[model samples]
Target: MPRASRLAVISAATLLVAGLTACSTPAPSAQAEADGDWTPITIEHALGTTTIETKPERVATVNWANHEVPLALGVVPVGMAAANFGDDDSDGLLPWVKEKLDELDAETPVLFDETDGIDFEAVADTQPDVILAAYSGLTQEDYDTLSEIAPVVAYKETAWGTPWREMIELNSEAIGLADEGDALIAELEDEIAATAAKYPSIAGKTAMFLTHVDTADLSEVSFYTTHDTRTMFFEDLGLEFPASIAEASDSTDKFSLTQSAEQADAFGDVDIIVTYGGDDLVAALTADPLLSQMPAVASGSIVNLPGTSPLGTAANPTPLSISWVLDDYASLISQAADKAE
Candidate 1:
């Protein structure tokens, strides 16, 4: 989901936009790790073996993994970095995340302005014991820099290494909540099944997933046909993918990228449209003849995502926004799918 969007990247200028259904701390409490464990768990990062110092105190998280586990485990990190960047026009994880932290009366961590590049000096000053870099791209330079601050746990196989589930396990283990982490995953699985059961019609339905590119032709379009982050969200509601989308993905060696409206329209029957936005999209549709003609649009079934804000990420899969998001979007998803009729 962190794929580079060709659409002009949000400059270092903005604020944010923003989870998931299941919120849990994993197995293995930090107390367990602290007991008889001087275990040398090496995270193969660009900088090489990042050994954990059992029972991390001051922690810093950058990407999704950074945001999720830290919060779920009841650790108010000393420093934080958002999963992505956008303007305050859409709430980023900050507001929602802050709410949870506030509920616990935990001290809020310092958030990195990702647009301006990660601030190593600020992180170094925190003197963190363990660093959760799971959802981050540990560039050679960044890695070198972060290692100086603390032992960094980067992705194992790829940049944002490992599946989301694995990420939970590993990050949880790192924090010594392995048991809690496993249970959290279980609860999430059950919730997903129940969610899917609620929208029986969404199953087998086709959907077109895209984010606003620019003022022009809606910029970049990402069409998901199968296993991916957005898929879970749609599947939870029993939503289906259009035939055209299935075909485009069929031609891809990896994930397919949509470049134009023609490619976007490939899923002609894409009855539902879910994307990141504020009113730019709603306004755009009303202003743009082409977009206004989308079958989903003509049928009045489009759901313009709440743009970037502190809690907007709730529509996505993350630890913080999951609980509140469902309550927020339930009406929208049900109505959108119902309108496809």
Candidate 2:
């Protein structure tokens, strides 16, 4: 079953040559031996602070893409949330993650696959020393429950609201690899800079990252806000969010804002309408009287994203997803910007 929160749209190819060139080798691990003594570290988060007495050898990750951080940092998690939305038939692991595991010659980590919510039993079965969920939407109850088994490191402020960079930093710190985390972030940033340079057309364009839902009468129309990772991904690419989206947004934590069809004209100023769906979604929106009026749509500046594509995986940027989608993402944005021009 597709998780509702797993909503996004985009595509990607294999890691770009530029990204590979920027990060020539895997980042070094920050285990207790490498970092000298494992000094106790205290981390403040939305739930409260969690203190780690020493470097954790058995790390377990919950929530979207949290496992990637430890994997990218050369640490294999003992357990992790299954890739509910994008996993192939191979035991709930994404291709990139599976590839990394193969390269490390590490045993396939235990996967927790509870669709309704967190699988506490499966997590506890791993007997992890620490549980990393710095980018998760786990509530206080969930945190308290997980804390019973191991120290739980949750998000900093809002649920599912930590930025990609912060997520990497927090996860790195949890595993006692703060310096390697910083280096990894710098490398990813360099890749983003190189991608921007390669596709000058995407810079400075105003974009709206939205999810279109066509109800019985074309009443449901909405877009994601700056709080959403998909929109943040556009900002990473140098695309500006239009003020119109802010005016329409009502809640900071809500992934998207659903508005009345009468207010569709509010989207008129956006240069690009980036959405997730099939090609027919474009046709559906273009046929709607209210939606067709938007400047981007009328001008053919709409970019339809496939739900399970690499670009979609990148809609919620992770340490690994960014590199996987950067080059193809740049090309998609450039194509839309050209139509807008």
Identify the candidate with maximal TM-score. Answer: 2
Worst 10 residues of 1 by lDDT: 12-21
Over 1-341, each residue of candidate 1 has an lDDT whose tens digit, in order, gives: 13133111221111110001012223457456445655656555444666775567667876554666768767788887754643363434456676788887976577765765676655655556677876566676677656655678776555543455666776777776788988887777676667656666556666766654465566445544343455446655567666676666576634336566544455567788776676766677556656666777677676777665533455556555555565446557667778887
Q: What global local distance difference test value does model 1 have?
A: 0.62
Identify the runs in model 2 with alpha carbons over 4 angstroms from their true place: 1-36, 88-90, 250-253
Which runs in model 1 stand beyond 4 Å of their true positions? Answer: 1-38, 43-49, 82-93, 160-163, 213-215, 218-228, 250-256, 263-265, 278-294
Q: Deviation in angstroms for 56 in model 1?
A: 2.0
- What lDDT does the true structure give each of the candidates? 0.62, 0.81
Candidate 2 residues 1-341, lDDT tens each?
24222211100111232244347533455344544678999999999999987568789999889999999989999999988876646468877788889988998899888587887767776767799999998999889877867788999998888899999999999889999999999999999999988888889999998776663467768788888877888888999888898666544568788778798887777999888888778887888888888888888887777777656666678888788778887888889999999
Candidate that would win on lDDT: 2
- TM-scores, in order shown? 0.74, 0.87
**Per-prediction tally of clashes:** 51, 4
Residue 303, candidate 1: C-alpha displacement in angstroms: 1.3
Model 2 reaches what TM-score against the true structure? 0.87
